[model samples]
Target: MKNYLILAAGLAFAAPAATAQSTASATGAAAAPISAGQRKAAEELLAATDSEKNLSATIDRMLSAQLEQNPGMKAVEPEMRAYLTKYMSWPSMKEDMVQLYAREFTEKELRELTKFYQTPTGRKTITKMPELMAAGMEIGQKRMQEHLPELQQAIAEKLKSQPPGAVK
Candidate 1:
């Protein structure tokens, strides 16, 4: 149950953007405040990319995939959907997402990205991202499953080498 909830939250919040992590300080002490122009550019970029539609599609795909993998979860599917839609829908998250982009990117960068997203290639990227992400995840899962035994073995070896209670 906890895992499902976590998965739901992760899926709902996952941005299908550049897939890069921010290098900002953990405490955000080094972060600069977002300017109004930056925020506006972020909003325009999101609009050009149809982020809301992509978000909805991503959530639907994630839920359907989860249900397919765990038939027993079907009973709670409606609740899961409702919870995600109520709390994490595009309307609810748009401002925060805009802030995120605004903080991570400069106003000029955002404007350039917005322009790119208005082009044919950029439009294709937006439309194809959900499917591309799904395929990428499938590949990653397959690779992880294949190597899981090696990871387990490495952990077991490290634990054996450690002094008793040292890990704690």
Candidate 2:
């Protein structure tokens, strides 16, 4: 559970810099500084989502499903479990996500979210968010897996095309 989330989180953390570099001509992270009120609203939304707990549960379910499909995974399951528990603990993840949310959204947007999420429709969305995120993650994993062969071929071609001294 933690392995997938951990890797995704790492990528997500790095994605912004890449995006910023790519979109340098675009509006940067400088519309306006996020206010304390908006920060509070963001924190409220985070609490309502149970973001970290939900991720931990989802990871548990995913790992269980994986182990079921591959019995051999049991051999290293204990070590994997220990690593996630130590490195991707709920407290650390929750703190990280809260900061991410605060940095990405404004107070006005967060306040609106607080208002909307309290509604019945919002409640449903909240309930289903984990399922949606998990499904999306699975789709992303499949797509990335699908690209591996082409990516590997591209790398091999690049290596072959380079001069002998370029390899060094």
Candidate 3:
């Protein structure tokens, strides 16, 4: 449950925009203040990334694949769709993200960021990010696989050492 909550929180707040973290920290909450121009720039940058549209497509593909793999999931498909639609809809994520940007960055920085994202390099970065993240996750999975047996052994040892009451 803890892990699920953590994952849910992470997913809930996760902006699809790769630059959002950097963009937020660029100015920070304590820095001067944001201006209208900066807000506009942030909006532009967000628009350029098209994170919501891309994420929506990716999620749809994921759900479709999941359904294809396990037809039994059809029993809960409507509930799952409702949950995602209510909480993870593009509009909800975008609105939360805009507020986050406004809180994090100065107006000037946001505008500059918008300009940066408009360039060819920026566009390329946007297009390649999903692949990059997927590859990174694969690497992490492989590393975990290499150590999983050792981890399981350690857990077994810990469980064996624990008192019967502690075991439960």
Candidate 4:
């Protein structure tokens, strides 16, 4: 259950980034030409975002909070520790996500995107995205809670309809 919640949280956070990447791709075809200075500015903004650092911090915080919420998780601490060790050791996950973005946009397209993001308007959007995502997740959680009872009841009824001693 905790794992599922963590996965949900991750997806929720990633959605905005995914949207940004898609938008970059979609607008790539006819984007306004960017100057060299603009490209450099965008690169600086990207560096400042420090995606890997942010992701690592978020993961650490989430895992710590999960362990606190579920003391039984202590029994699986070794597994969790091993998983985090492996995950953190792989520098490729962030690269892979970036590569996906790269694949979606040409080099010129990426430069233009970087240029736009470096601007005040773009910077503001980037800064507010995390908070926007958190709000989205809150809304999602409320909707899930609203439907949970009905979902549980449906599952219970379906299970009850099954034959006794049947392999699930």
Candidate 5:
């Protein structure tokens, strides 16, 4: 679960930069301070969506999930916790997450989202998001496994086409 959440979070954070494509523009955007209202609204949205609670749940499950999957890891649980704490602790990342959302959304939008998240349907969506994400990931993995031979063949063809001494 930790690995899954980390991958999900990594993709979430990376998606914006990947689309931005230029470091200078990305840096400029990062440097532009968010307005107070925007920050407040973003924080409110996070709270309404139970972002911190969700993160805590993920972290809580992580250790048990790891141990279940790899009993050998029990011997190194302390080391694993130290590493996860250093990099994945919510306290270290909450402000950055708030800023990320604030940057991506207008104050008005954030407020509207907060309002929606407070609704029953919105709450349901929040509750179901992890399950939905897991299902989608499973679907993707199945598709990838089904098509892996094609991918291997494509890679082989590409390698064959490359000059003997040159790497593609």
Candidate 6:
């Protein structure tokens, strides 16, 4: 009777351990995976940069400057401005940018990124990034000018090889 009682107690304890293992396996299998839409939304959320609004404004200013500097290109300025305005539709752009950024980061990574962005240096970089981009564009334009003749010649030759009435 004593041996039988010990065996029963041991069986009782072992039963719960076996149950716990099965429960854990079931839960691990039943968990739902992330959907594509959910992933996309998270990505867009993360991609939202602090500089988005200021960057749009800076781009508008640069376009205006370009129109002013080259009067001949002024004929197309209105169309260009309209296109830029359409492309930079602020609310949707912001949403998409945020989603894109969010996709690349896990929840913990986003928390870290938000903490950094909240700091003074991060804020300063966010504010100045648009102006820095404009400066880089100005430098790129100078380089493009130097290569324009060669670029034009290459385009002309490529066009010449196309079939007659083909879209140029």
TM-score, each model? 0.86, 0.61, 0.71, 0.58, 0.79, 0.49
| After superposition, candidate 1 runs with Cα above 4 Å error | 17-25, 30-32
Please give, for residues 52-167, the per-residue lDDT of candidate 3 as tens digits: 77767655655565567667777776776676777777776675566567666677767677777779998898788767866886798999999999999999999999988897
- How accurate locally is residue 96 in candidate 3, as Cα lDDT from 0 to 100? 54
Which residue pairs show backbone clashes in model 1? Answer: none
Clash pairs for candidate 4? none
Local distance difference test scores for all models? 0.80, 0.65, 0.68, 0.61, 0.72, 0.55
lDDT: the better of candidates 1 and 5:
1
TM-score of 3: 0.71
Query: Candidate 5 overall Cα lDDT vs. reference?
Result: 0.72
By summed lDDT, the worst window of 10 consecutive residues in model 4 runs over 7-16
- Would you give me the overall lDDT of model 4? 0.61
Clashes of each: 0, 1, 1, 0, 0, 18
Give the CA lDDT, 0 to 100, for residue 84 in model 2: 60
TM-score of 5: 0.79
CA-only RMSD, every prediction: 2.4, 6.0, 5.1, 7.4, 4.4, 25.6
Task: Please give the RMSD of candidate 5 to the true structure.
Answer: 4.4
- The prediction achieving the highest lDDT against the true structure is 1
Write one digit per residue (lDDT tens) for candidate 2, span 1-168.
Answer: 554455435433332233433343255544445567766887898766655666577557656766786677788778766766665566646554555566667777777777787888888987887678668878999999999999999999999999988976
For residues 1-168, write the lDDT of model 4, one tens digit per residue: 667357445533453266665565567755455455544444444454555655565556656767787877778767775666565422635543554444455566667667777788877876776667668878999999999999999988988988987637
Among these predictions, the greatest TM-score belongs to 1
What TM-score does structure 6 among the candidates reach? 0.49
Off by over 4 Å in 2: 1-36, 69-79, 141-149
Higher-lDDT candidate of 5 and 6: 5
Write the residue-wise lDDT of candidate 1 on 42-71 in tens digits: 999999988898788778877887888888
Error of 2 at 78 (Å): 4.8
